[model samples]
Target: MKLLALVALTMCAFAANSVLNRIGVALQGMDPLDFATIRTGAGAAMLWALVGLRTAPRPVILSPKRIAGAAALATYMIGFSWAYLTLDAGLGALILFGVLQIVVFGWAVFEKGAIPLLRWCGAGVALIGLCVLLWPTGQASIPLGGATAMTVAGIAWAAYTLLGRSEADPLGATASNFLLCLPLVGAVMLWSGAGPMPFAGVLTACVAGAITSGLGYAMWYRALPSLPTTVAGIAQLSVPVIAVAAGVALLGEPLTARLIIAGGLVLGGIAISLAARR
Candidate 1:
């Protein structure tokens, strides 16, 4: 029960980061790139601070591989923020997660793991649900730029997860990845002309980065060894649902019937997919 609760909490933290980004960028008028840069920079600093305080010897080593892995982290941070600037939180999450699942499943297959038929079926159902969730209604034109950015973010995160699978110490690896990526993030933000950030934006970005992204991701790594690839995929499906609720409750975003129905299908399909793994 405790493990399950922890997993749920971890997912909620992940979901809340999205909500925070949406609130800051969409509602608060903070530049998305600025948010990403500050969030990652603060997160990297906080993680290293904790590492310094802890006397444990580092369990992960940096190499060329680690540098490559850091690129994915950079992509996720930058792409996600850029995407959310024009996309709804729920829609952005749906796209990001849909790609993530497909990538992970493909990686599992390449590793010679058994691919269950039920899991594929679940994927199909979930895909359909995602289509419905993303399908624009009544002349609501999709933001092509935002959609592309979100897709890139999804692919980046998928790569990040797969990279973690190979690391002996995922938490240390993640921290190191963030540390390495921060400078790159800053450069991009500066190149994009992101100016001085507002105090409110800074606070929100730091909280999202340090607490939700940093610690939440570290905790996710702690739980990963106990979870199968399929289960991990399914567990992540909850993030979009949680974000939807947060959007409605905190951001005053309207909850439409379509979102409710589509979300149900998406989450239900993910549950079925994961359950079939056993």
Candidate 2:
């Protein structure tokens, strides 16, 4: 019961990040670059604080693996923020989740040198769903740039997840990655010359970072050891759905028939792909 509750809360946190980002950038007039920068900074601070509470202070070691993790984190943060500028929160989450599944599945196939038939079929269905979602329509069309950015974010997040698979201490590693990404985030902000950020936007970004992202990640890591791999994969399918629902209820985003059809395909394909492995 506790595990179920934890998983549910973690999923909500993940979904909340998408909603918060959309509100911050799309509704609150926050610059994407600035939002990303503040989010990373705030997440780093929160994670480091948690680390301090959990462990004795020690000198940090810089490793290649950590650097790679940091780079992936930076990519995901920047791309996610930029994508939300134009993409509807629900749609962006769907794209990110769908692309993430494909990337991870693709990498698994590459590593194994053989693909399962069911996996291939699942991937094909997911691809078809993506096409349907991105297809031009008279009523409303997805922005190419926003979809592309979200795709990049999804790929980067997949890489980051893969990199963390073997970590001895998930929280410590994550905190280190967030801290290491701070410099890169700052560099991007400097190059872009992000505009002034409203206080509401800043607060939203901070909540996304410290609460939804930082603490959520920590809770997920804690729960991961108790979860079956398939269960973990299946549970994540809810994040997009939750995000879409939240967007409609909280942000007053439209619920279109096209999204319903495409989302079903994308999510169903992902579920089939993961379930086939069991």
Candidate 3:
């Protein structure tokens, strides 16, 4: 029950990030690059502080895992922010989680010999759901640039998740990844010359980084040990649903039939994939 609660909290936190990002960038006119920069910086600071309190300070070891994790983290942050500029919060969340499922499932099949037939069918169903969601409809259409960026973000996040699976010290590793990614994020900020940021947007980013992302991710890592891989994948399916509900209530985003159908299929398919017995 405790683990379930923790997992629920983590899922809420993850969903909250989508809400905050959409509010900050889309509603508040905050520059996506600036929001990304602040988010990464604040997350690093918060994680480092937590790590310091947990144990005596020590030099960070620059291992290959840390480096790759940092790069993937940076990619996810940048792409996520940029994509939100044009994508609706709910739609973006769906694409992000859908692609994430595919990446993780694909990795499993590659690393292991073969996936169970049930999972394959589930994957096929999920792919069909994605097609239905993305099919060009006269009523509304997703922006190409936004969809592409979110897809990349999903892939990067999957890589980050895979790399962190075996981590013994979740907090320390997460802190180190955030810290290492700073330089890369900074260079992009400089190169892009991000415009002025609103104070409200900055505050929103801070909360997202420190509370939702930093603490939320730490909790997730702690819970990971107790969860099976299939269970973990299925659990994240809740995030998009939560985000969509929040987006509608808070951001006044439209709740369309297409979104409803696609979401049902996507989440249902992923659930089927993970729940099926070998």
Candidate 4:
């Protein structure tokens, strides 16, 4: 129970990254792609320093499968960072997680062979809740391009997650993916001419990538084996709510009635789904 609680706290750190990115780009006058590139670069460097060189596990040779996983991670990181330039953190998370859940659920069906009807029904309810949460009021127009970018990011993340599950060592695989992906991300930043990275933005990206995100993943998998599928599923519902509250508190983003109600509905639906499973 304590370990699961700790994992949930670390996951909240992952959730905070969305808000942190918003602070770096939307508020701090930094280019989104540049921010993303620096984030990956810093995270890679940190992993190399912290775990890559000193690990006792036989250094896993990079394979085609691993490279493919890195590619997906790079795409996800870049697209996610870019999306925050125009989208609210909470809204962005809703879209990202919504798509991610669907993609991952599909992957389970196709790759894992079968999924319980209860899991499918839970997914459907979560999907409907996400739609309700994201259903725009007539006040502001949605940025289709930004939304598309986030959806692509979600797809990439699903791929990353699936790849991890197939690996011999999930944490080692994640570290390798992060280290290998920096160069790819760097090349994209150079090709796109994303220049003049802000000091504050770079720092925020680095902290988010290296510390919170890196440790978050380690803690998540550490707890996953101990947690029931239903408990794990419900625990994830805390992510978007954390993102929304973090956005409001850290980014000074407004918490509108629509946002509050919609977030509540999403969280509530997940709660109900978990309860049903129990």
Candidate 5:
């Protein structure tokens, strides 16, 4: 029961980050680069505070692995922020997850992992679904720029997750990665512009970074050990659904027919792949 509750909450937190990004970037008019900068800084501060409170080993920020992690994190933060400017929270979440699955399995193939045929078909289905979602209908399909940015974000996130496998202390290393990413993200933000940041936007960025991202990740890591490997993987498939529902309820984003069909295919495909791992 506790595990179920924990997993549910963690999924909500993960979804909330998407919603918050939409709110910050779309509604609040926060510059995407500024939001990313604030988010990275806030997440870094919160995570480092948690690590210190727990008396964890001091994080190593300059290591090659840490630098790589930071680079991936920077890419994810920037691209994710840029994507929300035009993307509905639900659609954005779905795209991010769809591409994340693609990258993960692509890497598996690259490493000569023995992937099942079913998984390959599943990946194909997911690709089809993403295409359908992005298909132009002379209507409200996501803009190409937003979709492309989200795809990049998803790829970076997959890389970050894969890199995490080598970490000795997940929490500490994550904290370090957060810290190490600040400069890179900041530089990108500067390259873009240092324009005005709204108080509300900053608040949303802080909430997303500290609460949804930092604490949420910590809770996920805590629950991950208790979960079956299959469960852990399958459980994440629920995040996009949660984000879609929340986006509709909170942000009044449309629940389009196209989105429903494509979301199902993408999620179903990933679910099929995860199930085959059993």
Candidate 6:
């Protein structure tokens, strides 16, 4: 029960990243690239302080895994920040998690060469639910640009997770990942010509980076070892739900019928897919 609660906390932190980015970029009018840069830098600083210089991970960049992990982390950060420019917190999470699971499970099929029929069916249902969310209903439709960016972020995040699942030291690897990406993130912000963000936005970015992103990710990596692939996949299904509820409660985002119905189908389908694993 304690461990479950801990895992749940990690999920909350993940969900909080959406809210924080929304708070910074959407509500506070920070430039998306600037927010990403601040987040990467702040997260790197926090991780360095925690792990210290002598003990920090020095993953060999020559390995295919290292290059892939680094690229995925950068893509996830950049795309995630940019996506919040138009997306509501809940809506963004729905799109992100929906894409994330599809990619992860799709990779599973390739790796194992044998996924169950039930899992495939559930994946199909979830894909349909995602379409329902994306389709232009008379009242609301997800913005194509924001959805595309978040979809990219989601795929990158899944790649990062898969590649890092077997890390010998989750904390150190997280620290290394943050530090490695900090420079590129900063460069991207500079290239965008974003200047002088509001203090509120900076504060939100710092909180997201130092707490939710840096520390929360470390916790997630540590917990990954104890969870089977199917169980971990199922556990992440809670993130969208948590983000939706938080978006409504904290951000005052609407809880529309479209979102409710689509969220249920997407999350429920993914749950079925993961739960059916042998």
- lDDT scores of the candidates, listed in order: 0.81, 0.78, 0.81, 0.71, 0.78, 0.79
lDDT of 1 by residue, 1-278 (tens): 66677788899999999988987787778998899988898778777777778777874546886787779989999999999878977678888888888878887888888767888778777777777776556878779999999899988988877666555665677689888888889899888897657788788899999989888877776677777776677678778877877888887878888778878887788777767865
Q: How many residue pairs clash in each candidate at the backbone level?
A: 0, 0, 0, 0, 0, 0
Q: Indicate whether candidate 2 or candidate 4 has the larger TM-score.
A: 4
User: Residue 276 deviation, candidate 1, in Å?
Assistant: 2.0
Which of the two candidates, 3 or 5, achieves a greater lDDT against the reference? Answer: 3
On the 0 to 100 scale, the lDDT of residue 164 in model 6 is: 66
- Each prediction's TM-score versus the true structure: 0.90, 0.82, 0.86, 0.84, 0.81, 0.83
For 25-140, candidate 5 gives per-residue lDDT tens digits of 88889999999989888888999988889865686778899899889989999999999888766568768877776676667668787777776776676666666664445677
- Return whichever of 2 and 6 wins on TM-score: 6
* Segments in model 2 whose C-alpha atoms lie over 4 Å from true places: 1-5, 56-61, 113-139, 222-234, 253-278
For every candidate in turn, the CA RMSD to the true structure comes to: 2.1, 3.5, 2.9, 3.0, 3.5, 3.3
Q: For model 4, what is the error of residue 55's alpha carbon versus the real structure, in angstroms, after optimal superposition? A: 5.6
Residue pairs in candidate 4 whose N, alpha carbon or C atoms collide under 3 angstroms: none
Q: Report the C-alpha lDDT of model 4 over 1-278, residue by residue, as the tens digit.
A: 59647866866887877777887888777888888877787766666565656656744649897798789989998899889877876578877877777676665556565455655566566656556655566788768888999999988976765555534565666677777888888888888887667788888888878876666655565565554443454456557767777767776768777667766666666656555555
The residue pairs found clashing in candidate 3 are none
Model 6 scores a C-alpha lDDT of 0.79
| Model 5 pairs whose backbones collide | none
Better of 2 and 3 by lDDT: 3
Q: Candidate 6: how many backbone clashes?
A: 0
